[model samples]
Target: MKYDFDYLIVGSGFGGSVSALRLAEKGYSVGVMEMGCRWETDTLPKTSWNIRRWMWKPWVGLRGFFNIRLFRHVMVLHGNAVGGGSITYANTLLVPKDSVWRDGSWSGLEDWESVMPGHFNTAKRMLGVTENRIMGPADILLKEAAEECGRGDSFYRTQVGVFFGDEGEVQGKRYPDPYFDGQGPERNSCIGCGGCMVGCRYNAKNSLDKNYLYLAERRGAQVFEETRVINIKPLNGGEGEQGYEVTTQSSRLFGGLLRKRRWRVRGVVVSASSLGTQELLFKLRDKGSLPNISDQLGRRVRTNAESLIGVRLPGDPEMDKGIAIGSGFYLDEHTHIEATRYPRGSDAIGFLLTALARGQPGYRRIFTWLRTLLKLLLTKPLLAAPLLLPFNMARQTLIFLCMQTLEGHIDLRYQRRWYWPFSKTLQSFGPKIPTFIPQANEFAFNMARRIGGLAGSVITEVLFDIPVTAHCMGGAAMGKTAEDGVIDSRGRVFGYQNLYVCDGAMLGANLGVNPSLTITALSEHTMSHIPPKQAA
Candidate 1:
């Protein structure tokens, strides 16, 4: 069968970008479809408060880069852009603990400890990993808090993807072709603007579009931005044997009026993050486009077991003078917390955090919320008053991104609920994951006590038993067979050929750190399995 392209990649983030570059370099025609818009450095939002350019809800006419998708059990924060999550991510790239490789469906499938190092090294080189140059007040406070918790030895600077310039004279200066020797774009050193999460406008952050997607385009790969894939059907009644018939529609505000377009491809790589891959596959399977998808499609969904905690200081102290995520400390073997921040005047995220509460789901959580609010009102009335007032959150707050390597996850299923009586949507299923982690709260309380500030957490975790996670992983996990998982250890769907999943959806274990680097390394490993395109 003649194909329009050798490979069709969905989502232009870490996984899709890597696939497009490697496949196109191997002489295959590659096309990447991204539902988000292309973002240039100068065009990025000045701050998260710029909702029209910082938040995404196209139908409501807010076409931004960040998406906050709320499920019953979890609220997922992710990026939507040509560079994927890299556009809005904090740029910290740390490898997970060795124990992470031993857990989950993919465990024992390969000798991961021995083989992953090489791929990780290649990914690091391409991403331009560097040691953080500026350590702001937030990093110092984290160290002090670690000492208060008797874990001071565990505090360390994070390895980030930001350029910090050559080791000598000046910092935050522009440099020419540092990583790829003129093949990649020129970069400026990080000015410690704390704007990485708001979209790095200084050209300091090593986003994928500056590296992988840029190289892929130079190799003749095509990227279709603002095009969302709607349907994927196996052609000639067989998956991959006769290629695929792919259909997509515009994702703009006027998408409903736009006619859908169709294409054909010899293979499809679904790298649309974890949530996206699960939703798309669920729709296709239910619609009978690909009927052989495994029953384990939406199982083992991990969220890094995360919590966002913070402490608000009354005085301005320049907390936003460092990188978005500058440093971290491990509370214990399983719990890790990083000092996170936004640029000055970027206070939109502050609205999502509230006073910390501890309890299980249901009525007990509501009781805990009331008790915590009462404690704040009685003991720290001065701090409680500011919660109702307008303040410079970035200049006076220290944000903590807390995560756990503990293997706790919630499952997702597609259903038509009563609230939304229209189309089927993804819903959280099964037991509720823990909304409050004791170690994280203890650390936050200790930090607030030390600094005489107010400690807080996400309000959704208290009121609705939902934790916010930036790293949503593992819905189409890798297993030995179809009965056990959706895809094989090699990332190919079971009972199907030439159909692959190489994104966060394939992650069986949650990395305690950011999952971007792991996703890139895993994509590199998956793409290496396929041979170069055969000469006609």
Candidate 2:
């Protein structure tokens, strides 16, 4: 029987993009349904001159998509573009520690730590991962501190997916693909605009749009943007068989101007982000759109236990003018910190660094940062006046990004309470996440202290403050038991056939660094279970 392509993809992030490319490569007709637009990187906004215009969001509208807000711990940054989060994230890619892989419930499924190397190698090759070739003052200073504390060996530059130009050429110069062997489009060098966190205007960032998704679209994947899937159901029946009915709402046209649209497909893969995929699955399960979904719907959610803290260079004031996450410090076996940056002259959206004290619910890290600001204000006129100068703040501020492989997770469940009776109180929030304690990550704070850089408090509760996560994982984890898993070891839905989850959501534990590699690797592994897409 004919279907809408060979498979349907729910999101356009790393996992979805990889599956799209691989499936399309084998001549399968694929449809990738993304909730955002195809943001053109060639002319994307950069610099403080146009940051508000650079960020992206979907809930509040296109304008709100880009002009995102950052709290002390959690910085709500997501891309409302066809390429998803890759469109806006800094390319500081680092694989998680082996320790993280060992703790997950599915750790025994396969030799995750050993067998994943080949997949990771392929991901690196595909992503153009390389040691950061450019060094700025912030990185150099951080290295100095790390070396002084005897952790210099651990402070090498990150393997970022940036394209630095030919010798002596400025970073923005457009040149042929440095690693593509003339196979792909010309690549522009990184101008180091620090806008990567917003969106890379330089075309230097290896965002999936330029690589995997680009090639996938070229091969045969049909990509739809600004199309949010409102509901999903097994058309043949909710049982393990046949086509699917995908109901969607277009964000492009006005509400009344358009009507709900539906499509049919044989197989479906959920790759929307942790929050997105979780909500989509929850809706399908709760509203009975797809009632066969597992009872463990929102289990194993992770935040990477991350935080961001900023440090100002002693004398240099413009240190925030580099790549968004240029350098970092690894304090110990568990705690990792990076020096994240924003373009110069942008709004002072301060830094984050973690393992901090967790506060009472409803009164979180954001409130704490507010309190800190209030304390500073209250003290400025009395004692700390001299330190309140703009120069001191800029120079002394060290944007610290704290991360750990320590494991903790949240499960997504319905609040079931109505907001306005008509409003969707079906909100997705953490279930009173466990408190973040600093003592567990003290080796890292001590490393910073040894270098004279003070511990950047959470500005809020640890889970809420210093929050830095590019790869949010596991709401639908893979396991052998429904009591423990959502997707099986083969990525198939626990009780159903032809449904799979091949993204970060499948990971059962927190990865300490950028999780794109692991997601790509997992996607590749899952694709092996899916035979080459049948031709139309």
Supply every candidate's count of residue pairs whose N, Cα or C atoms clash at under 3 angstroms.
0, 29
Please give the range of 10 consecutive residues that has the lowest summed lDDT in model 2.
349-358
> How does candidate 1 score on lDDT?
0.89
Instruction: Record all residue pairs in model 1 with backbone atoms less than 3 Å apart, i.e. clashing.
Output: none
lDDT of 2 by residue, 140-202 (tens): 767876787677888867888777777787657888766657766788888765667667766
Over the stretch 1-536, how does candidate 1's per-residue lDDT look in tens digits? 67898899999999999999999999999999999999988898897889999998998998889999999889999999998999999998888887888998889999999989999999999998877888999999998888877899999999999998877847668889888889998889888889999999899899999999999999999999999998888888886777899999999989846758989999999989899999999999999998899999999899998989888888787889899999998899989999999999888987887777666667787887788888888987878767544357888889999989988888999889998889999999877878778878878887888888888888888778788999999999999899889998778998778899989999989788889999999999999999998898
Clashes of 2: 29
lDDT of model 2, residue 459: 38
| Cα RMSD for predicted model 1 | 1.5
Each model's Cα RMSD = 1.5, 4.3
The CA lDDT at 185 in model 1 is 88
**Off by more than 4 A, model 2:** 47-52, 55-59, 64-76, 167-170, 238-240, 256-259, 312-316, 348-397, 418-471, 534-536
Winning model by lDDT: 1
